[model samples]
Target chain A: MELFTPELGLVFWMFVTFALLFLILAKFAWPVIIKMLEERADMIDKGVVYAQNAKEQLDNAKSEAASYIAEARKQQAEILREADKMKTQIIEEAKAAATVEAKKVMDAANLAIEQARKASEKQLRQEVSAFALGIAEKVVRENLASESAQTKLVDKLLNEVENKN
Target chain B: MALAALLLAMPAQAAVTEGEGEDFNPKEIIFHHLGDAYGWEVPFSHSQRIPLPVIVRDCQGSWHIFSSNRLNDGASYDGFYIAHGGEYSGKVVGEQDGVQYRPLDLSITKDVAALWIAALVVLLIGFSVTRWYKKHNMKAPRRWTASFEFLVEFMYMSVIRPTLGSKAKTYAPYLLTAFFFIFVMNLLGLVVIFPGGANLTGNVAVTLVLALCTFFITNLRGNKHYWKEIFWPDVPVWLKCPLPIMQAIEVFGVFTKPAALCVRLFANMMGGHMIVIVLTLLIFIFAKFGPAVTGGITVFSVLFSLFMLLLDTLVSFIQAFVFTMLSTLFISMAVCDPHEGHDEAEA
Candidate 1:
């Protein structure tokens, strides 16, 4: 019972002692300790914020890089397609040129063949006429055994030709 | 001759039971340990003790300062003595002509001596930490200073900053000091050895002073808006009209908050010490049965007391934290912007 009761002396001593303690510690101890602590806490907070910002920036860069890669791949495929189309067009143009050249060469060769046939035909006719004349003259010379018989034949052919005229 | 004199003195100073209690009163044992005394009896020894100084201003208006050993067993030294386990168990009273008046006993009793030791230790720690900061400026602390920094930082971040908000930076030093002081005292109380077992925090007067400090700071720094919120709260108009009951409760809360802080710390610490003493005393209480019974009881007593002491160790930290945390909370509430709470509620 007495233990629970508050005594004046103890209370006074406690008040004086605690008041002095609080003041001493607050003055001497706390300033340095608390300042250091606050500085450290602020540093930690700044560190976390910086880390988060860096992470976000990295993520953004990675996404942007992915999009860039995709765009480059698309452009590469388009260029390859254009080159393929141009290659096929060049092949078609070469084929058309080769056909026109072949046609001109065939026509020139046909004209040359026709002129040679005509010349041959003229020479054949003249040769045939000359042969006929030579044969007839021999025949006249031999059969008539005289010029009169050949002349009679010639005169008869000339009279017939003059009546027809 | 000295040796013979010491041997004689040893027998004379052997453990003397102060109270007239039969059957090994465990209650008396607890009271004896928990109460402030003029002497500190060394545990586990019979004849060794330290006699504290006794300072008393008696009815004669003159001061008598002497060794408290003169008042052994309620014996008077210059008409002053300490009564043990009575209506006036923990006081110094003077009897002159059958008139008893309480003396102003501002003496270095057991608890006072312990308080000085605790104060010295706190000062030493404070000085060393200050020196560390001085020696190593802007660099990270090392070793024990690092641990101390961690503790202070924890209090700053967890308790002070969150509660006090902007004012936290200003009040952090005082709050940290209060926290460390209580923490050291509680831990010191847990040590049962000669040098460390001083129940400084368990004393009501010490807790009261700490609470008083908090109370004063909170009330003194409180703004008009705080008082307005307490007196005329942002409640329904009818609520205010009803006998101002809400307002009265707020006023009561102001005082009770600090009172609760003091009582809570004192009771918890005192209770822990009592439980430890009582548990150990149970063995002696059962000793008359038989040697075998006494041996069994002693074993259980020692084990249970050990467990209690461990629990007390944990309680010491928890109570200290609780006390400091509550103090921080109360002060922050008093000083924080009242509109912030209202806005939060509205949102």
Candidate 2:
């Protein structure tokens, strides 16, 4: 029966001790611990979000860098092609100019040789005509030493002159 | 192992022989061990005990305070003594020939001292957790402090939060405090030593106070729906108006919740302690046969006691969990919106 009975003293003390314990803990301890727990959870969530943003930024930067490299490579190829075209053009122009210079030089040399040959032919023709005329004069002076022969030749010459006129 | 068992069983054996030269009465010894006292019985010696203060008022209405050592062995002091053979047996009584009256005993008995010790232990745990969080904000603490954090998180998240939802914050402190208080007391009762032997949780008076706290909190915090359900439940008009049968049952359920809480914890703890004491008393109970029988039974008794102590430790944790869970459920039922129940059923 005593086991079932609730003693007044024990009951009084239990209420006092337990009530004070609950009040003190609820006021001082629970709030701080629970707040910290919530704060930690919030921090973890924020950290995850921040990491996701950083990864996205990293991905963006990687793609941008790849595009820049590709553009740079394209520019390099364009410059190389232009340079090769310029090199071929310069080589072609040099060959053409060399051919033109050779032709001009050959034409000038042929003109000088033609002019010299013409002059030489004219001189030779003049010299040959002069020699023929000297031979004809010597033969006419020998034949006039005879009078009869001179009268006959003078008549024939007059007749031939009249006919020619 | 056997030597340790004997050492652990020594206190019960010593208590049985303290009355000296009388036949070994296991019932008296068991009850003495179960009951609260003014002095703490130390092991291996019953003539001397750690005396506590006895605060009493005599029949003359004068207050008296003295050390309980003066009342040893049925001794009397200043016309006040421990009554041994009456309705007031094992209580301090006034000097009278018959029908002596009991004084207003406000002494710090073994149970009260044990209560104080248990409260101190709980407070220490609370402060230690607070200190860890204060020192290193979000960082997890190590060792026992970490375990304490796990227990708090587990209880709040799994039990309290699921039951009470947003109101978990409001009631978590009381529930958590009750949990650690009951748990520490239950564990302390299992140890048969100076600081650990008082059966605080086994006392009906202590559990009554605990249940009362829960009772008051549940009723006071109950919302309109809760009261409506109790006074005018959602039932047929005939059941409520003609006999108030459904309403009566609803009202009965409200009181029974807390009553069940009180008795369940007290009886479970008391039974555990009683079994251990009875098993230890077997050595003396079987001594009349011979040394051989006594020796064999002693071994059996000690082994069973060791097993019970281990089981009680587990029971301590479980009962603490059960009490907190039930309290949370009750509070949630009172405060929860009726619409939520409908939504849950739909889902």
TM-score against native, each model: 0.73, 0.84
Per-residue error at A117 for model 2, in Å? 6.1
Q: What is each predicted model's overall lDDT from 0 to 1?
A: 0.76, 0.84
Q: What's the lDDT of the predicted structure labeled candidate 2?
A: 0.84
lDDT of 1 by residue, B115-149 (tens): 77777777877777678778987677788777777
Give candidate 1's whole-model lDDT: 0.76
User: Which ranges in model 2 have alpha carbons more than 4 Å from their true place?
Assistant: A97-165, B1-7, B10-12, B15-22, B59-61, B95-97, B288-299, B340-347
**Model 2 Cα interface RMS deviation (Å):** 1.1
Please provide, for model 1 over A1-165, each residue's C-alpha lDDT reduced to its tens digit, 9 standing for 90 to 100: 655566677788777777788788877777767777667668989999999999999999999999999999999999999999999999998888888888788878888888888889889989988998999888866888978887898899999999999
- DockQ for the candidates, in order: 0.39, 0.52
